[model samples]
Target chain A: MTLIVWTYIVYIALSVPLTVWVAHTLHQNGRVFLIDSFHHNEQLADSVNHLLVVGFYLINIGYVALALKEGIAPADLRQVLETISRKIGVVMLVLGAMHFFNIFLFSRMRRRALLQRVPPPVPPQAHVPVATQ
Target chain B: MNHLYVLFDAQCELCVRCRNWLAKQPTFVPLSFIALQSTKAERRFPGIDALKPSEQLLVISNEGSVYRGAHAWIMCLWALQNYREYAQRLAHPILLPFARIVCELLSRNRFFLSRALFKQEAQSVARLLAAHCRPPQTLCSNSRASV
Candidate 1:
């Protein structure tokens, strides 16, 4: 029980900051593209970026918390280490999946915005008739 | 009858303008154009209700692939000579998402833009064609001939 408790505390401490850092990186880098997508609407872009960050926090933190319960209590040091590693590994996978999912959603939004400004293609014309010589 | 067939809204001024612009571009593969509401479109794509003639642009490649919306727009760009590189760049990981957004927005607001910007011209595409054509022939006759 003690080992499991310590592992949970350490995981929370490490994972929270890591998630925040990754989210921050995404926010900073993704802002410019979002601005361009929204036709230079900084307000809209910033709002969207903030919303995405908030969602990232909620989903990741929620996952981290929910995944804290160990299936079986660790009986020894070796068991404790194995349990902690397995938990952290799962957290890392969840984080990576969430990150990619967020990117996919943002990419879709950006695509729609960019395409809105494209001019339509020209209609085809038939060959002009030649006057009889 | 070409490598790519583009179907667009004939009544849209914006669509007409785009069609004219596309016609001017130099492309490696020939792109044939037809109005979405035309008999040709009806015959070619018999049962796909998703391709509402006036709503969105459609592109059918020689390989029998149908691309609508952003994909269709990208395919059109890929057919262009000088703009093909830009098309490829636009499809990149960093850019494709934004491109899709732009395409969707433009597709949604095309009619409004047509009315606002190209009202006069779009209202008289036939007249413009007739005047622009050297021999003073009607576009209707030419359209029939093409059909």
Candidate 2:
């Protein structure tokens, strides 16, 4: 077969499993944070988690497929390896970026939830001044 | 803008150091520091006894809410950039009593701890103040003749 065909095969073979592994890891680890962020609403947290994982898969798989077309078709095995490495590197960076973005969103949500639960510190009586004789 | 006012004992070296540390933290909400003995603190929070300032750490929110001891410490942490998780964990039911006990222990012995651990920092602050107050030679000589 041609180098282009091999490149597609190698890319898909490597990318799909990597994407699945990362999504699974994020789903597992992020559940606790999401639960806390949603104020211990387990159903809401689980639904959000499932939605995030689905979105992650769609974005990453779509990117991998779109990015499979090389600028220059590889003529030799060395060229093929170099192109694959470059594509994989970009995919890895995109995955990392997505992970951090999700974390940032969840952290902000958690902070807001915490603020909501915190009781107001001062009583109305404390604001009143006493008359001095 | 919401603000958290931290009332600290200015005389305690550790308290001063802690204030400096808290000042450096990235905060979600602005934090204002006031010495419990300061006239400003007295004016802002009337009827609180300032004589025993080291007894508890007090944090007053902009909404007029007051948090004391461990709760005040947790509020301070919650206001910090990345320490919110720790604040949440400490506020948990299982850990809250422990947090309170630790806060109480620290509050009761802070003066001694300050002297033992932060004497050098206190001395440095005194030196810095002294340097600021020192008159320039030319100004001092000119003013001396006027006097």
Candidate 3:
């Protein structure tokens, strides 16, 4: 009915689907990384991946909702466009940051898991044969 | 390796304390601690005395590989769950020498460090508790009798 209402409508329409798309992309690609991190346990990897996506969605959508009424009510089409663009820009930045944070977390997990398989860094000084305990 | 055997100086309070602490930690690989002077250590590794095990850290894998000194300390950490990353970081070529120096420093002055860090505080705490928390003579006698 009003420019402000149109701005809200456009903002929600843009933000929700954008969030979903980014989430879907991450879920598909991050599966492999997660599997490796969990040492090829697909069931555990998928469970963790789903949990991470759910958390990501909750945080991003919650941010979008809370940030909805942040600025002055739009009075014109230009104001509506500006408000929507600013809101969408913030959402995209949040998404980008979350994506990178997720990558960082999974990489750390993979590094630790791989460390478990690594050989002792230094060679032993001597070998002593012994009876089994 | 599935298991590690750590030989520590039982005579040194700090080494024994460290052994106790290491024993209590959650580990990826199981650890067995043996006193360097213990007959078990002697039986398991005859001539272990010749290696001067009391002077340096010693670690034995289940497969019979012996890691001495700095490498032994790193192997000990590698067996632990939380310290494994630290062990790996310290094992880097650049850091290994530094780690060795640190381990040697701790090992060489362990008795002095133990006196400074553990014994003095423990004695102070005991003195404070003794002064502040004296039991009634009757209760003390009753407790002793129960024991």
Per-residue alpha-carbon lDDT of model 2 for B28-133, expressed as tens digits? 7789987664555656666555323347888877655667888889888878866766787888888988998999998888867876776545465444323322
Which tens-of-lDDT digit does each residue in A22-93 have in candidate 1? 789889988987898788899999999999989989998898888887777677778877877777788788
Quick one: best DockQ, which candidate?
A: 3
Among all candidates shown, the one with the greatest lDDT: 3
Q: CA RMSD for every model?
A: 15.7, 10.7, 8.0
Q: What is the lDDT of residue B114 in candidate 2?
A: 71
Clash count for each candidate, listed in order shown:
26, 5, 0
Instruction: Determine which window of 10 residues in candidate 2 chain B has minimal summed lDDT.
Output: B138-147
For each candidate, what's the DockQ?
Answer: 0.01, 0.10, 0.49
lDDT of 1 by residue, B1-147 (tens): 247878776656677788889989987567988665455554565544444535567887554456677777877887776576577677677887888788888888886887788665544755544433324244322542321
Against the native chain B, each candidate's TM-score is: 0.77, 0.78, 0.78
Q: Residue-wise lDDT of candidate 3 within B10-108, one digit each (tens)?
A: 556677778889999988889998755445676787666666776798999888889988999999989887899888899999999998999999999
Where's the lowest-lDDT run of ten residues in candidate 1 chain B? B138-147
Deviation in Å, model 1, residue B97 alpha carbon: 29
The TM-scores of chain A alone, one per candidate, are 0.84, 0.88, 0.95
Off by over 4 Å in 1: A123-133, B1-147
Docking class of predicted structure 3 = acceptable
In model 2, the Cα lDDT at residue B40 comes to 53
